[model samples]
Target: MRFLSKKDVPFKEVVPDGYIDIHSHLLPGIDDGVKTIYQSGYILEQFENFGFKKVITTPHIMQDIWPNSSQTITSNLKKLKDVLVPLGITKIELRASAEYMMDDLFYERIKNNDILPLHQNYILVEMSTFAPPINLNEILFEIKLAGYIPILAHPERYSFYHDDLKKYDELKASGFLFQVNLLSISGYYGEQIKSFAKKMIDQGYIDFTGTDVHNYHQLEVLEKGFEFKIAKKITSLMKNNIEFS
Candidate 1:
């Protein structure tokens, strides 16, 4: 949770333009993201201005907390679009997906084939920062057996894995693609996370990058993140996001 000083560079100068954001919490009032339609619209405008052409908004689908379903996410996205289209905020194509917390509910959903994916075959999943699930590998295997690619969100922020970075390599070997948060490189999450993010980038372990944007303040940090030297280095490594763009 340490905030690093921002480098003096424009965001557009270093970051590639028109990349598709694979993970975000853009739907209003559904989770720990924007609370109102106005907030959602404002952040979407900022994302577009920051060089994102499309945003696949992944709201939290944790059963113990958010408990959002694919239907709820789609309905909320439609409501936001209904307001934004007439207001001329239609430049960025918005889509709905769920960030499935790797918990019991997620396992049940996977078994029932009732989860929402980022694309046709790619699902975004996350674990608790304090500790990983005991059946993490088993769940990942099930996800792949179901014919879906499992993309792990913001692996650098998981403090438990910081001591042993090789855990990242093991997960990658197990077919879990890594998505580092853009702000992690700017030390927005903390110095340790920033260090791990840089290590992942240096080793060419990152398959994608995302804003993981929830509100305006997070967006501000993300704009500053573009000025980080690591941002430019990982620009060519964001193939997973660009392919979907």
Candidate 2:
């Protein structure tokens, strides 16, 4: 019997039409994502081709590094939109939000009600891959108190939790929604992350999925990932993103 290769599978087969993309870093120049308006347009055009109906492009809001505010994200989003119209890349609807790093700054933002929500008061959040914040529970409590649903970005990538799988269950019990990265299932981050992603899916912990695309290289990798055997499991979660639409 001839086994099919990953190249034989296409990304469109996994993601359906009118699918809503809940995470990405397509905003140009504000973070580590696409560097210019042109690059942003290129990624969006690819998103359009991949059957994404809308993309909620999230830029990093790490206080020490990116420090992007609602004003900054909104401004760059407008700049990207203006360029996209000229590039004829208007098929996919675009919106802006922040992948907030859970730090002191984020706590303050929660207190001040200064936040850019993804949709319907849901906010995408991330913690250090090295270690979660010492005051994580407090931050999560504040997030809920502020009326924002906290969706943890790429839960499988957190190395600290890899050893203690029950931490995932604790997080779920705490009302944290998990967004697994599409690339992780493709083994783009590494075998460890890839395995964890699969495990998360098996446990039914993944609430949503995202490309988390930062550059052209990653985007290409994302396309190739569709060919992986695990892509079938990831496809099931892809439909969940439309809730944000």
lDDT of 2 at 65: 94
Clashes of 1: 0
Q: Residue 227 of candidate 1: its Cα lDDT?
A: 43
Residue-wise C-alpha lDDT for candidate 1, range 74-135, written one tens digit per residue: 99988998998877787899998889999989988898899888888999999998899999
lDDT of 2 at 150: 94
- Per-residue alpha-carbon lDDT of candidate 2 for residues 1-245, written as tens digits (9 for 90 to 100): 99887555677778866889888999988889989888888889998998899999999999889999999999888888888878998789999999999999999999999999999989999999889999999999999999889999999999998889889889989989999998888779988898788888988999999999999998998777555566577677898888998
* Residue-level error in angstroms, candidate 1, position 212: 0.4
What's the TM for model 2?
0.96
- Candidate 2: 10-residue stretch with minimal lDDT: 225-234
RMSD of 1: 3.2
